[model samples]
Target: MRESSSSFPPHNNTSNAIHKFWNTIKCCSSSSTSASFLFISLFICTLFFTQWSHYIYFPHSTSTTNSLQFSNWTTLSNNNISHDYPKKDGYVLNCSSSKALTITCPPNYPPSNRNHKNFPSNQTCPDYFRWIHEDLKPWKKEGITREMVESLKEKAHFRLVIVNGTAYVKEYMKAYQTRDVFTYWGVLQVLKLYPGALPDLDLVFQCHDKPSIMKKQYRGWRAFVFGSRDPPPQFHYCGGDSTFDIVFPDWSFWGWPEVNVKPWVPLEKDLAEGNTMKNWTSREPFAFWKGNLRNGPRPKLAKCNSVNKWNAQIIDQDWIKESREGFKDSDLSKQCVHRYKIYMEGNAWSVSEKYILACDSMSLLIDPKYYDFFTRSLVPMKHYWPVNTMRLCKSINFAINWGNNNTKKAQEIGKEGSKYIFEQIKIENVYDYMFHVLNEYAKLLKYKPTIPEGAVELCSDRFACSPMGLETTYKIETMVNGPSEQGPCELPPSYEPLTLKSIHDQNAKIKEQVLAWEKENYGWSWWTWW
Candidate 1:
């Protein structure tokens, strides 16, 4: 009975143990499922936190990403947010209105029309380019004065600023503070200085030949004036001498016989003799001339130590001959010298020519005319002039004080002074003389003319001239007329008109290419910065 009882107890124990093991397995499975759910929820929360941090730190990046995604959608139908949907960080939302996003037209758009409105409308008048006085004010700072303005107004025309040489107007205009200043033949300075005292001038016109616009504009005025010996073609239309109330030929001692009065009067003498001598000195006839004339025999060679005398006649001729022979015949030494030097012509021509040549160093002398002629070169030397001429010439190396030209005594003094200059001045030391001359010229600008009691009448409006009409009339005749045996003068062909269809066709092709670029680059958004 004990054995049977023990066996039954063992069986009951085994059954109970099996039941506990099954219960343990069920509990383990339940714990594992709960842990898996918690881990997944934590991972989702961490991802959302990371995305929110990126949105807060970099709003532009997040907004750009959202815009790209939105643009990909075919239809804008979804309205509500869902839990499964990718959440948009609130900080990354765009707050700008639709109107703000749209491009607004710039105030300065359609630049062509804006420029047209601002530009002067009347092109006929002298003041057309400058409808208001403000436009002319900038020129005033350069040297133009109120008196000049008034003179231009009284003249009722634009002023003439003739440039006889290859001078850059922009450079000269900047150096002086007056628009009245011109770069014409330096001899013209004498004539310009006379009428320069007058005001009422507007623009300063310059050209190789006078334009037709000058004549048309001059008709509206009372008279015209000119300093040049060459008269405008419209002089006949205006009644020749009567057409021009005043004529001041830009004459000097060293100018062409036609342009300048004779005697090559010294500057000091002209100053002392006053306006009577300055204005009334009529040109001497070639028949009665006592001094050297071009038609007369060439000057003889005399003894001189100046190297310019020898070099001018020999070296210069050789160099010129070589230059004519072309590059093959040119000696290396001579070529090097020429490259460093320039040829200067000084005589009875324009002083502007001297200024132009003197702009560079190493200028050689072609001839010797007057002492003032030497003043124009910044590096003048005796080597510039012909040997024979310089040796025989007394005027080549002297400074004449013409203010005391009482008699032949003054002439003797000039001769002695010239000899002294030749003896003392060396080619290497010529720069000193150049500096002295430049300084004196610069100092002359400070000098104001002390207008004598009767001088005011000389610069009156009666003598003032119109630049536009003077130019226009000249252009009509000179340009339209064909070339003569004297020279070639012709007008350019007329301009052709453009058609609307051609312009439209060109514009269409341009627009197509522009549109193609825009489509590839997301339209006009690229120009947002501009």
Candidate 2:
């Protein structure tokens, strides 16, 4: 009972020595081991145990066991399923009861980029391409002619010509020159670039507008048709009665005087009161002529929330703001919309001719270039203040009477006219109306004589047909003859001669006045080779 308890404690020198030795050995080992080495050993052991535990717990997880496999798991719930337990790439075992479950990820398992599902940019033409092609092609084809073809030949020494002038004034000669026989002359009138003219002839096509003309000089000729349709008092029919093959006037007699007249508003009067003609006139004739004599002054930049003095204060602030905002970027779509609402001009011999030809329901004002510039799908409002009422009655279907000296009468007429226009004309239906008008114009073209007389019988059919026939004529003239011709000469019998003499008599007196005026003012005498 009293025997020594070995299991109990016994303080012995031998055991103490052994413990001290072991402690010293442990301290030495710890002191020799580096912190990084200790950390690495712990990390390796932890990783090994963690992997072993994961593999034991999740035996079905191939991704956990195989380092190569990686995946993303998405959980989906159904009415009967409380949790989805379908196996996936990195799925871990879980205990759950559910009637249905689905597990899915991208087919490749690891996605290359975050936004791979987005649609790519389109590199094809827009839906409107077909329509655009249809509309522009036919018109473009009308200008190809024999003269144009001959102009292509390098040794021919002939270049294709395009005379930008009043169609009525320049048509007779243009038609004559673009025929098959005149292939050597290589003349065609219209606004277009000839492929052959490049790098050599450098021929530039002509445009009626001054702005366009200034950019590139016309190849053949430049003439201005003068006189108005408003017979007597305002404008005398001079060229209408002339015998010359071509008779053109200066700036004075083209459109209604109101188009040139300053605004009647008090503010305009005040602005002009101290300004002299010399001060206001531009040094560039083209600019001055265009703004004052051709298309009215460029539409004042639409001011936001401000009054527009030029438009008679009729334009609403909202409208101005909208228009200005729309055109801020100068994009074609936006600019075209603004352009459609404004008036444009082309070349014309007389103010009356400009008005008659320029009147359009979609255009904001009338100008000589309306037909060419406005195109279709636009409505025109005319500047018809100074024009003769009788001529107005016969010519224009849509007009804006800016009022005569009698503002009240003008306002009344404008009100009635505007109402009629709003009811009868719409932007959508403009082309239909234009085609109808063209048909009517064609009838007049048929009855016209082949001679230059007055505005009534000048055989202006040439002008109307020239747009299409001119091209055909040029092609026949230039290309048909091939490159065999030795020299350029006038076309034979390409155009019919204008011969009605009665119409010419009416403007004889006016012609005398114009000739006298030219002599006195410019010190130039009237000369005609024909």
lDDT of 2: 0.23
Error of 1 at 509 (Å): 72
Every model's TM-score = 0.17, 0.20
Supply every candidate's count of residue pairs whose N, Cα or C atoms clash at under 3 angstroms: 40, 34
Query: Residue by residue across 13-124, what tens digits does model 2's lDDT show?
Result: 3355456645655655455558756875676555443332221100011221212221121111111212212223321112221111212222331112122113222333
For residues 82-144, could you state the per-residue lDDT of candidate 1 as single tens digits? 112223221121223211212222232111111111222231211111111221222323443
lDDT (Cα atoms) of all candidates against the true structure? 0.23, 0.23
Roughly what TM-score does model 2 have, to 2 decimal places?
0.20
